[model samples]
Target: MRPFRATVFAAVVLAAVSVSVPVAAAAPGSGSSLPGAGPAVHPDNAALDCPDLLVVAVSGATDSTADRNPIEEETRQLWSNWVGNITVPVGEAKSRYPGSVGWMYVPYPATYGLGLFQDVPTYQDSVAAGVASTNRILDEQKTRCGDRTRFALVGYSVGGEVVERVARELGHRPADAHVGPDDVAGVVLIGDPYRPAGVDSLGAPGPSGGGFMSSEPADYGDLTDRIQHACRPYDIACDAPEEIAVLELALGVLGQMRFTLANPLQTIADAERVVSTMAARAAAHIVSGDDWWQSDESLLDVLRVVADKTRPVPDANLGPDRLREILDWAVGPGLPVVQEKLRAEGAGFVEDNSGVVELVLKPYIFLAFIQHIAYWNNNPHDPWYWESEKIVDWIGALAQEERERDSVGN
Candidate 1:
């Protein structure tokens, strides 16, 4: 296989093309913040069909249901939370709007947990798919609803990454971009992996102080005002510093090498183990409320930290039954070993390097315990809970603003 560093640029570029969007680090137009110098369009929006108020919501990675896609699930939830679950029936919402409040779900890979080494390309493809699908939805919706439609966009996790790209695409209107600034009411991002450190977010702050898995600079262009990012604490996918990720990846490579030297056959056999561990770790950041573990040198020392950090959760107001139920959901089926280690060893080890051990072990702990996949159910007290609500509230507010504007215009 080619060296990992050599593959990085090519992979990123290919991923960019796959999503039909530019992934450049420089400001648009040679350091010019001006929109005129931004990257041109990838997905054509010429055929978009918009309504008076259109809301598009995309879900996090692997956030799909058997019948509904992630975007569809999120839209359904948003509508349910705001309208459907309320006294008003859902169908009544459509009638109340009268083609006013339209929503579209974008289709993408939404790959299941872990194996970043192999799955990154799939993510790129999913990004492309998401862009195309969203554009198509907009086109179809607008065609059916009319050109006067306004749009509100929301995304979570990798879905947040996709929405960021779409926002950038909208910012730099193609020569044929029929959708203008006026067409967008607002954009909401929840647990966004691409959320920059300094960017204004409504809810929890990003954990890493940097965007997830991306070292590139993000230019939201004109959409800056309307964009709001919600990243819970320690959600490295959204806030983990780029340096930490790079360090972890480097550690993982070393761990792979160490394992390969021990037994090449064993290393081959352990591919799934290593990849899944890494993926679990990455996913854990999105759900974990705290870092819970850190290292100065000794493995046992870090384990102590892990124990201390995790001890508080069970000791909280949570009762034994609720805790058991939560644990059942987290460690169900193929994940008992994760809980066993935390309860028994306090931490697990894969190599001499603490970081490597972390890569292999952290995921099991976080994935088994933390609530990463479900944001809609986040408790009101949790930092992410308010953030999630903030987005929904903003969408409703934006919709109301659009309606009032329409009323005044009429």
Candidate 2:
């Protein structure tokens, strides 16, 4: 094997081992926060305390201290420095618009755990918390401010995922929701991991490749046109290539689990889904005689037979009484077969697609960290594009428009 392949395999092994271990739990009510959030433009007690526009900002994962317990960190109000990306624009908007605009900063766990090493909440937990907190605040504000106020959402990285999820829910206009599609003025996403390919950025054209988790189509429904996003070139979070799908999916699963230990059923469900999908794809490649196979289909067929034999009865055939039996089969006998198939087929696929992996995948994986974090600053390569400045300008324009509407109404 080549040096780069060896390195990739080693990293995958490390990640696999890391996610197997469990981390500590978060403190109660740690998911919700209003701390350091600026006051409403109108007084709390006013009968119709509605700002013409309200911007809700959600920050990405924060720095974790090894010395402190996870619980302590959860309770603290420490936000990620990336929040400056959101705050700067919001501050400028507020300064320009004054009483016409209001700001709410959501504080969440924002901790990305790395198993036994990093003592923090898992990526899933952190994002889940952010979505919950953001929605709660929106609901409260919508009820308090009445129908006159308009809402805009801003988020960076993981927070972008949260904002997108909330926006999707609102766009669908769920009956339980306090705010609907008409209530949202705009959504701004910076370095979102779920950004779709070919979508134009706030200022310029975005990357051709979609995000790591972009396999699932993002359905924002009515709010689709109102959304804007920015993903710098070579950023793996948003620009992952189709050639490295398996590797990207594996990394995504690890990030979702992290070290905080996800629920057993949820973890199994996720793992099963990933494994089955990979196996199905490999089977398709074999049938199509794709260059990656490099071997006879008989071997893969045998593996598939074994998997079929081990798989539990179809869910449609099972009753509530047999749910436990299916879960046991999924966790025990069924999962390992597909896992083994992935292990056997993944290396050969990579080896066959080494050219793309060398030129695109390697650079993307190596530079992802720097590219992901550098969105707040101007890209040295593309001097004309500065994500933060664009956001500030866009938000300020929104505020100005609201102010103008208010003036016209008066």
Winning model by TM-score: 2
Q: Please give, for residues 173-263, the per-residue lDDT of candidate 2 as tens digits.
A: 9545568887888899877877877567785787776666552467998898889988887777677663444454445455544332434
Give the residue spans of candidate 2 off by over 4 A: 1-50, 63-79, 93-96, 115-119, 174-177, 256-362, 377-385
- Give the Cα-based TM-score of candidate 2 against the true structure: 0.64
Instruction: Give the least accurate 10-residue stretch of model 2, judged by summed lDDT.
Output: 64-73
Error in Å for residue 9 of model 2 = 26
Give candidate 1's error at residue 255 in angstroms: 19
User: What are the lDDT figures for the candidates, one per model?
Assistant: 0.46, 0.58
Of the candidates shown, which would achieve the greatest lDDT relative to the real structure? 2
In candidate 1, residue 55 scores what lDDT?
A: 68
Q: What lDDT is reached at residue 1 by model 2?
A: 6
